[model samples]
Target: MENKLKFSQKHPLLFGFALILTAMVLIIGAMAVFNFFFFKAHRNSFFGTKVGVVHINGLIADSLRITNWIDELAKDNAIKGVIVRINSPGGVVGPSQEIYAALQALARKKKVVASMGSVAASGGYYIACAAHKIVANPGTLTASIGVKAKLTNMQGLMQKLGIAEQTVTSGKLKNAGTIFRPLTPEEKKYFQSLVNDMHDQFVQDVARGRHMDIEKVRALADGRAMTGRQAKEAGLVDELGGFNKSLDVLRLLTGIKGEISLVQGPPEKSSLLEKFLGKLTFKEQILGPRWVFTYE
Candidate 1:
């Protein structure tokens, strides 16, 4: 028999090109399947009357997600009102304030009600003030209005371990909160002033949101966590009840006679890499980073 080359051997270049194209298609299909399973968005009907629920769970590290949800609810016509369910101890000052501001803006367009859960203190209560009404469980802990900065001095540990860190700065206050050594008196005073200013901002915002006198808010803004009943007495909470109570309040406010459907935001989606490294926080990555002003 005469020797004959196979089709793939005769067309090596075309075979290679076909393999590459097949890989590309497979990759795209896999990506589509992954997105469908993990990153699909929540779908809400545009015609039905719905009430949006924004849950502020755990620490408020970043405001991007919550603020984006608020913006979406604001533009959605199907969402007649919103119930902000809070269950957090507190978090970073800047992010907390951003969430509060976003809620305030949303409250202007739609009826916003805050429903406090087991523990909604500090920054949690700060955001709740932006709502038109606040409902809390009788045993719920709320209102820890204060600013705090936590720093650690690692000088002794470094000295024992013979590890030294050399830092160059332009000014005396430039590297204020270095963990290499204890804070100087001047640094302490400066940090205290910053904390006071942030606390004042918190007090002023709470007063404005609750429609109470600044002094009254100042009196209660002593970093004291109070029960829902106590907060109601102090004019910080509007009502004492749980989620169902909040639903009735929203129903009454929006005049929704029939079944009130609760709409929540889509599940949080993170990249595959983020899922693996989400818990690792490198605090020393920043220069002279020791103090973190928070509402805890």
Candidate 2:
């Protein structure tokens, strides 16, 4: 008994240290569990005030997901406003126009601010017009207000490689943009007409959103890109500033007082192999060789 008492007395500090460590571990574990459940449910609300932030990065191939996010934010009472951060050269005409339309709908309910990043040109800028205000850095590349259909003729390449492709289609226009052969003059005119019609639609949307004269917007919609500074001068952008500036504008427009919490959409998850290969690839993976009506 005396020997045991002596050992206990001598190691009292160690015993206390171990007890504290055990308590800390239990507390940390509890916190982890609580956070996992509670925060996941209340992810959209932070502290008290909440502002939804949607990031439009990379090539905009589709708008369904983003439009859904905007719709959710618009309906959420906690979400006061939305900030759309865009960094894209542009992508398919349909997707871009769809996103722009969704943003316009969202803006009708809540104040929407667009924050332009390094390369918000073409479809990127097209979508930005739907916002209540646009903020961009002075040096940011933007205002590629045009549409293009990229068609690649690989017939010579296939010939060199001793390859040939045969196709059966319902109509001549069905194979109009095929890469197997060069476009005939008639095909070229048909495609050009399609591009021109889409371009006119783009200009109309921009003019409607920016509240500018349609003719004015048309004058600047000649497939020419411009820097943010130039865009601001041309009245394409409302303000010349970065992300923070955009937030400030949104705060004022939304009448948000005190601290604010920004809730952004969850980033798309990618596999480990995809992440690894993406880093090594020189060019971005295209959906396919389909004719892309893009602003790039």
Candidate 3:
């Protein structure tokens, strides 16, 4: 009986130590996870103001996903302003301009700044021009002031490849750029007119946003690319600087500097452990990111 009693007493003590060790491990794990979170949040803010970072990193689309972020930022009083980091060539004509308009409307209420990454030209520039201020890094490539439509007539190839195409149309322009045959003169004229109209709207929007003359903007809208410095000279960008520099400008404009939150693209929804312990790695994720970005 005495031996059994001693064992029982020792068992509880051992159990207590084991429990304490387990708790320590858990606490350490949680601290590691959340420590980085605080660091990142604090690091992102400037002058005690939260600066939201929105990333436009792919082909712009018609989905509200992008516009919704902007709207959210506009409503959040915690976010003094935004810094849109753009890295894209361009995408569908309509979606690109739609996003630009949304940002312009947001700017009326709060400071909105743009930060051009490796490539913020074409439709990317379309959106950038809408911001209250624009910033580009030393090597940023921007300014593709143009619209392009590619129509493929695969009639010959389809026939050669044993594929066929047929069409019925209510209007003459309904089957305008049909791939089965070459574009007729009327069809060409119709497409050119559509493109020209869209181009005019683009030019006007850029001119109004950049505070530049319509004539000068029209002159530069010839479908060409320019470096960050060159774009500044042509009035395509407001300042030649990087991301933090852009934030400084936003701070100056908004007159608030503390913790800056961002209205950015959705994060890639995978955890670090999920990648490391699992089969995929960061490289695979990056390689696949473009597919997600393009929705293709």
> Could you give the C-alpha RMSD of every candidate to the true structure, in order shown?
8.7, 7.0, 7.2
Let me know the TM-score candidate 3 reaches against the reference structure: 0.76
Report the C-alpha displacement of residue 239, candidate 2, in angstroms.
1.0
| Selected candidate, larger lDDT, 1 vs 3 | 1
Clash statistics: count for each candidate? 0, 0, 18
Candidates' TM-scores?
A: 0.80, 0.79, 0.76
Candidate 3 residue 130 C-alpha distance from true site, Å: 1.4
- By TM-score: ranked, best first: 1, 2, 3
lDDT score, residue 47, model 3? Answer: 30
Candidate with the larger TM-score of 2 and 3: 2
Candidate 1 lDDT, tens digit per residue, 58-95? 88777777899999999999889999999999888988
Q: On a 0 to 1 TM-score scale, where does candidate 2 land against the true structure?
A: 0.79
True lDDT of residue 101, candidate 2: 86
lDDT digits (tens) for residues 1-296 of candidate 2: 99867867899988688789999999989977787687865533436578889999888776666888878888898889999999998877878888898888899999999999998999999999999999999999998889888888999998999888888999888889888789999999999999999999999999999999999999999988899999999999989999989989998898988766788873553688865665444133244655767755
Q: Write one digit per residue (lDDT tens) for candidate 3, span 205-238.
A: 8899899999999999998889999999888888
**Displacement of the residue 97 alpha carbon in candidate 1, Å:** 0.9
Candidate 1, pairs of clashing residues: none
